[model samples]
Every structure is written in structure tokens, then in C-alpha cells.
Target chain A: MLVRRFVRRIAQFLIVYGIGLAGLLGLKYVLALSDYVVPDISLILETAKEVIADYIPAVFSTLSVTILGQVISIILAFSVGIAGRKSSWLGSFIRVTAYNIQAYPIVALAPIIFILLGDGFISRLLIASMICYFPLLLSVLGVMAAPVRDIEHFYRATGRMTWQLEVKIRAFENLSKLTTVISGSATLAMAGTIVAEFVAANAGIGYSIRTALYQSDLAKIFVALFLIGIIISVYQGLLETVGTWIIQKTSTEASSHE
Target chain B: MNKKYALFTYILLFLPYSFLCLLIVTHSAQAKEHEIRYRLKWLFNTSVAGDIYANKAGYFAAQGLQVNIKEGSPEKNAINELELGRAEFGVASADQVIRALDKGARLVVLAQIFQVNPMQWIYRDDQPEIKTLNDLQGKTIGITFGGNDETIMRTLLTKAGIKEKEVKLSGVRFDFMPFFRRQVEVWPVYRNSQGVILQDKLTKEGEAVRFFNPAEFGVNFVANSIITSEEMLKEQPQVVEKFLTALLQGWEAAMNQENETKVLAAVKALDKNTDARIMQKQLASTRGLVLAEAEAKKIGAIDMPAWQQTEAIMLQAGQIKRAVQVEKYLQVR
Candidate 1:
């Protein structure tokens, strides 16, 4: 199942990438643009072959930060979401703060971050987390705040309901949604890391993209995009597989108890 | 009754035909203006003062051209716009031009804008003056890693017999905090625009700063130059010549010390965020970069050797796969 899921994800990404590339090539031909403007497929393939080895390490550097940031954001989002689930003043405040922070452009805040943290791994990680955190937080908050009242009523009526039990009931009931949100946030995490690198950081695929832009090599950029897309797809596929396993196992255990 | 009906029909037909003729005449008159789009390399500042001046001063109109001058950013590549049939002419740096040419872009260089490349390093006066290239040892220098500044600096270091480990290189962004905080001893800036602003800010704080120009150390990587696709030059040679003549004239007038105030006012209208004082200083610096005293008469002359040297530098730095004989593409009017 894992292998099939992973293969499916890779195939989906390849199809999307191919179509997008075809569209670009179509436009290039229609406009009769030079290779400098939009490179031909052969040039892209050649450049990809040349740059893949170097870009792999750069992509891994980006992935490491992306994974780290996503994990940090997940932990923070769940913590904040739980605290804010009660619809109390503190909860409302947290929601307002998250909305405000998300509304504020990350690029505008990047200079302050660079000033404080410098353009190192920390800055990239922080920016990535900040970008990926808010949406996750909002989703988690929505799930946690909306009660699974039908099932919770039984526990409440029996005087056996605790906060932990309430939280677990809501999370389990909305496992599909929670998993989808977590999986979706992976893309945001990767994008955030790339943006951080593009804006300031010296390392990663984003930096390589910036270099290619300076040299005006569209082929290198296309190659980088393919690698990033494939890697992120594999990651998201893994997360979904894990989520499925957990869901199945929990359902089986609950049925046995019944 | 039949005669009256026939007269009314003739009057209606005549009115429609007359209106059509008037419309055609108006359009033809407008077409005489020869509308074209000219994309600048960067934003509206002293760096593009001459371009803005040419439009504002009616130089283009005098040549029977209706030019729309567009502002450019890093993402808004003029060469791309040209290939997509959006822009007729554009200002591109030497590296950009060479890189595009190497990639099968049929572009031609019409004129060189900055006689002296404005890309230079700004350093605090407190630091030991870099009289020689060897003086750059052990200092943390800021470079936009993928930028032309990196290529130029690396060449300088190599020429000085300095290894990469001998000095620290920091990646630069839009912020100047690192340089302000003294974390970076030397920072790269365009001598006319950012250089003027940085100098002004430091001078106000009672800190003197000096610029280290690579040209003085025998590295002359060319800056922005006027470019157009080969098709435009080949098909409409007359239009190209007229455009070049008017542009060069506007640049000459804009660079003249006598016309500094007028040029500053024109630049100020487009770039209101800049301080009036800074604008004045920036224009002065631009005048120096655009035309040295000896070359004052030749504002837009294509510096062939500079172009060749720029190509050579890019090739040596591995920015280009092979040598693009840039001279063959240069159409010096």
C-alpha cells in the first residue's frame, strides 16, 4: 500500500509537471521566443542532467529545514489550537494574533528577522514555521473547537468526560480533516523554506534558483522545480500513508472494544 | 414625394462616408508618431535620470517617436519583453546581454549608458584604504552571491593572489543592516543610487565612507547599455537611428552640469521618495559615471573594449558556457 501510494504521488507530480512544461513550450512557440526567454525541452533536459547532482544536495538542505519547520509548526499549532478551543478571551486573542501575523507579509518581516537572527539556518527555519504555522493553527482550532457532541454527550452524562478525553474524541472524529490539513501544510512548509532562501539565505535550492535567475538560465530553474515538486510529493504521500494506517488501526481497536 | 425620398437616402450615405474618412485621417496622423516601448533596467532613480529626461524633455517627440518608458525590476527582464514583442528597446547590463546572446537571443547593443560602471564597494573611512588589491585581506565583504559583483570581486581576489579562505564573504540582500552594524566591512552598491544614499546617511552620522571602484583596479565590467532585437535593427534601421540619436541627445543634456537642476526636478517627479539633497548628489554622481570630462561630447558611444572585457570576465567566471563574440552584435551608431 505504501509503495503504491508513493508511486501514485510521483506519477501525479510528473503528469502535472509535464503539462505545465508543455504549456510553457506552447507559449514559447506561439510567441516565437528565443531559448533565452523560454528554453526548449532539449535544453531543459540537458541542463537538468548537468545540474541534478549539485541541485540534489541543495534540495536536501532545503528539505531538512522544511521538515524541521513543519514539525515545529505542527507542535505549536496543536498547542495553540488546544488552548484556544474553549472560545475564551485567551483563545480569541490567539486567533486574532494568528490572523494578524498571517496577514502581515512575510517578505516585509524578513528584514527584521535577518537583522535579529542573521540569514542563517535559524532565520530560514523561523520564517518557514511562521508561514506554515498559521493555516495549521486555524485548521486545528476549527477541528478542536467544534465538538463531537453526539459521542461526547454519553461521557458527559456518565460524568466520565475529561479535557483529554474531549480532545481525543474531537481529533479522532476529524482524523481525515486533520490529516488532510497536515498533508497540505507540507507544501506550504517547503515553499516557505524556499522563499526564506530566495530572500536571504546562502544555501538551498532557493539560493540555486536565485543564482540561475541571475545567469538567466530558465532551464536550471525548470530542473529545480521538477526536483522540488517530486520530493515534496513523496513527503506528502508518506504523511497520508501514515495517517491511513493510524485511522485503520484506531477503528479496529474501537470496534474490538465495542 | 419620390424625389424627396431619393435626396434623403443620398444625404445619409454621404454622412457615413465622410465620418469614415475623418476616422482614417485621424488614425494616420497618430500613426506618424511611431509609438514604441523602451524598458529601463531599474526603477525610477538617478540611474535612469537620462531615460526619464528624454521622455520629459520631448526628445522622443522631436524625433517623431511616441516612446513609453517602462520601469524595470529584477523579475522584469527587458530582453524577455523584447522577445515577447512587448518592448522595442531596453537597458540591460553587460552580463545580461552576453548571457542572453550565448543562449541564442538575437539582441544588438546600440549604446553604452554608463561610461564608468557604477557597481562599486562602499567602505567606512576608518578601515585601511585599499590602495592595492592585496589590501582586501581578512575583511568581511558583502556580495550578492549570484550577482555580477561576485564575479568582479572573485576576479579581483584572484588577481591579488588571495585565496577564498583569506577573506570572509557574506551574502547581501536588500537590507544594509549588516554593513551598518559593522559586521561587513565592505558592501556592494550602485555608485549613483544606493551609493549616494548610503554615503549621505553615513556622512550625516559623522562617518566618512569611500568607494572602491573595480575599474580603477583594471577590471572594467560594463554596466547598462541600450539594446534591441536584431529584427528591429534590420527591418527599421531608420527608426533605430532616430531613436538612438534622440536618446543620446537627451542623455547628453541630462548629464550636463548646467542642466543638473532641471534633470533633478524631472527625476524628483518620478521618484518622490528620495530626499531632494540625495537626489542632487545622485544626479552629480550619475553625471560622473555617464560621462567623464574627456568623453562629455560622446554620451552614448559604445565602448567596444569594455564590452569585450565584460564578455571575457563572464566566460572566465563560468557565467557563460562559451565565448560570445559580443563585438559582432554591437551596432555602434
Candidate 2:
């Protein structure tokens, strides 16, 4: 039975990859026939490889911003989520502040940040964190503040302390939801870094895109965009995998403790 | 006898008072400085040395105008800012001006700055010699696919009778690693700005760099020029004239050998990113491009033939909807 399942998995993988490869080839052929792209296959392949190789620094720049921003976001989310449940006015005020921050357009704010921080790596980090902070905070705060009525009643009837209820029951109950919100925040983090880079960056894919626009090099623009897409996809995938691992490991520990 | 003396004194006072009133009115009219915003094509650099000099040296102030120089980024469109009335004057290349005109924006060219477009391809000295356009064949040429450089390169290829398949066209970004690593043979740059900086860097690393300027091969794609909307020209022709005159004076002063130190100091004050050494070279390159040809002997001279050729090239490339009477837009002083 195990052998058969393994074979089936391999077959599925092959089929999926086969379809993807076929689609790429079709697109390449169409683009080659048109006036938009260079028609030579070997040249196109070399260009792609060179672009990817050259964009490593940009990839790292993006990742550094995303990782740092997400770390700051997680801390903010937990603090806001826990504290917000204590008082209705505090919750309302915090929510309003978050909304205001999110509402102010990044384009206007980026230049201000650049001026304040002088276009350093730290400025990019701060810009990314600002964008990532709100969504994660709001989502986590909402889930933690409003547990299901049945769960709330059960914990209260059992005479559980507020800390005990939060730590043992509510936290586990919202683990998956928390992970989902964090994953979404990662997406916003990528966008924020790029926007900040566009305003005042010495390096990164955003700078590359800006330079490409000046030269009217459509190919460079496409390459930069393609790399960005791949970076975001990899980020989302990692978030998903890490979230799944945490949930599984925590669930196992809880069951053993019970 | 006392009444006659009083009448004489009152008449003398009235005549002097009238002359004083006339003098005040004329002085105020001449002294009123029009506050106008001039949008630059890019951030503060050697590219905008003249604009900086004009602002810092009180050239605009001398002309009874208060000009605010606003820097632009990749996302900021100077022409669009002009259309929206956010700026009175702006800098744009022939490509941008053509595109704006194609979209029905009534912008006029004030003065062409660079005698030749600074856009060119830079290759290492060790690479194949590119003395002529035909030499680009069988070579890997880097282009920003939708950029003006790409348009120019494509045109060059067509003119040289070289097929696209004959050469390798690669995409490049802001990073010079691809060119350095030999993945791309020729890379694009603004000859007077980034070109000088890149060449110096490469040369320092023991790799000398040479540029493939399109003008050498007879393709003159116009670069940044002083631009303003028709509304401004029609409503405030005097202000426009004063501004242009002062700006031209600023350019002439900036290019003068005696004023190099002042010009460099003014440009450095605005742009703090570039190295002083690189900036000096860049300034020299800028002077060369801005004041190269015979027509450029008079700073800010409008080269009508170049503008016409630029428009024709754009039309041929299908970059615009129709041929614009390019001369109708140029208001040469």
C-alpha cells in the first residue's frame, strides 16, 4: 500500500510539472514570434539566467526587509491582541490608529521617511514594518478578543483564571487563524519594501525597475517583475510550511499533556 | 499778494507728488517676482547642474522671478505634473514630450539643454571594437526592453541592416554585475551622468570602458529640454521670457571655466550621494554635451533640425499617433 501511494505521488508531481513546462514553452514561442521579445531561444535562456544571478542582492534586500518587518509585526500583534481585550475604549482607539496608519498612502509617507531616516536600510525596514504591523495586529486582536461563546462559557464555568484561559484555550483555538493572518502580512511586507525602495534606494529590485523605466528597457522591467513574483511566492510557501509545522507540533504537545 | 504765494507753493508740491507716484508704480511692476515651480526630470545630480546654479546664484531673482526647483523620481511624471498645473515649467525628453503630446497635452518646448542625447551603450575596452553600427552584429547588446535605449538600439540595427537574430539582445537592470561578468556586452547609460561614474569605477578596477554614442552614427534622439504648457506661455509670456533668459544665463555661467568651482559647489549642495571626484568628471561630461556643437556656442539655442529628426524618429517607430508640427512648439528666444 505504501509503495503504491509513493508511486501515485510521483506520477502526480510529474504531471503537474509537465503541464507547467508545456505552458512555459507555449508562452515563449508566442513571445518569440511577436515583436515584443528577442526571438533567440539560447539568448533568452542566457538572459534569464543572468537576470536571476544579478538579482541575488535584490532578493536578499527584499528578504531582509520582510523578515525584520514580520518579526516586529508578530510582537506588535501579540501585545495589541492581548491588551486590546481588556477595555472597549482602548480597543477602539488602537483599531482607529491602525486604520489611520494604513489609510495614509505609502507614496507620500515614503519620501518623509527617506528624509527623516536618510534612505538607509533602516528606513526600508521601518517602512515595511509599518505596512505589515496593522493587518496582523487587527486580525489577531479580533480573534483573541472574541472567542466563541461556548468556549468562553466552558472556561468561565471551570473557574479558569484569565491568563490560564488565554494561554491554554484561546491561544490554541486561534493558532491556525493567527498563522493565516501572518502569512497575509508577509505579502504586504513585500509590497511595502518595494515602495520604499522606489522613493529612496541605492540598491534592490525596486531601484532596478526604476532604472529600467528610465532606459525604456521593457525586458529589464519584465525580468525584475518576474524575480519579484518568484520571491513573493517563495515567501508565502515558507510561511505556509512553518505555520503547518507549528500547529502540528503544538497539537501533539497538547494531546500528550492532556 | 499772500494768496498768489500760496497758489505757487501748492502747484509746485502737486507736480513733484505726481512724479513720485508714477515712479512707485513702475518699480512695483518691475519688482514683482512671479513664484513658479520648475520640475526637474530626475533627482538632484549633475544632470540638473544648470537649474541648481540658476536657483542658487539668484539668476531667477535677478529676473524678478522666484523659482522653486522640484526634484522628480521614477514615479513622478514632470509632464503630467505640468498638465495638472502643479508645476509651471518642467524638463522632459523628446520621447516623453512626444508621448504627452500624443495624449493631447498641449506642452511646448522652451529650450533644448544637451546638444546630443546622453543615452549611449558602454562596453569594456577588452570587448570587440564597436567603431561602427555594423560591428554590433554577433555581439550581445543589453537594452531596457521598453526604454528609449531599446528604441534607439532597434533603430540602429534597422539602419545598419542587421537582423535581430544577428545579435544577442539582453535585458539589464540598474546592477552592473551582468556587464561586469560578461553576460551582457554593451550596457546603456546617460553619457554625462551615470556613464562617467560607471567608466571611472570600471577603469579603477583595471577595466577601461568606452561608449557607443548614437550621434556618432547619425541618430540624434533628443534628451531633456526646458518645457512649459501652452497656457503658461499664452497667459504670462513676459514671465516665461524672463524665466528662460535667466535660466539660459545660469547655464552659460555654469559652463564657463571661471565659474566651475561655484557651479560644482551648488550641484554638490543639492546631491550628496555622488562622490566629489565622480561629480567633477560628470560636470565636465555635462559641459561637453551641453556646449559641444557650433549651435551650442549660444547656450540654450533650440536646434530645430534635431527636434524635427527626433519627432520623425518617434513617428517612424510608431511611438506617436501622428506627426506633430515640431516647430510650432519650439519658442526660441
- Share of true Cα-Cα contacts across chains kept by each model: 0.60, 0.10
Q: Per-residue lDDT of B205-300 in model 1, one digit per residue for the tens? A: 999999999999989999999999999999998889989988988998898888888898998999999999989988889988887644343787
Model 1: residue B301 alpha-carbon error in angstroms: 1.2
* lDDT of predicted model 2: 0.76
What is the clash count for each candidate, in the order shown? Answer: 0, 11
Candidate that scores best on lDDT:
1
Candidate 1, pairs of clashing residues: none
For residues A118-182, what per-residue lDDT tens digits would candidate 1 score against the true structure?
A: 88999999999999999999999999999898999999999999999999999999998998999
RMSD to the hidden true structure, all candidates: 10.3, 19.2
Over A1-258, each residue of candidate 2 has an lDDT whose tens digit, in order, gives 444544554554444434434444444343222212211334334446757776777867877887888888789878887778555899778877877888898888887777666556887888888888888878877777776677778877888757656645677888898888888788798888877776656567776676656644344555676567666766766777788889999999989999
Q: What's the true lDDT of residue B155 in model 2?
A: 88
Question: Using TM-score as the measure, which candidate wins?
Answer: 1
**Residue B114, candidate 1: C-alpha displacement in angstroms:** 0.2
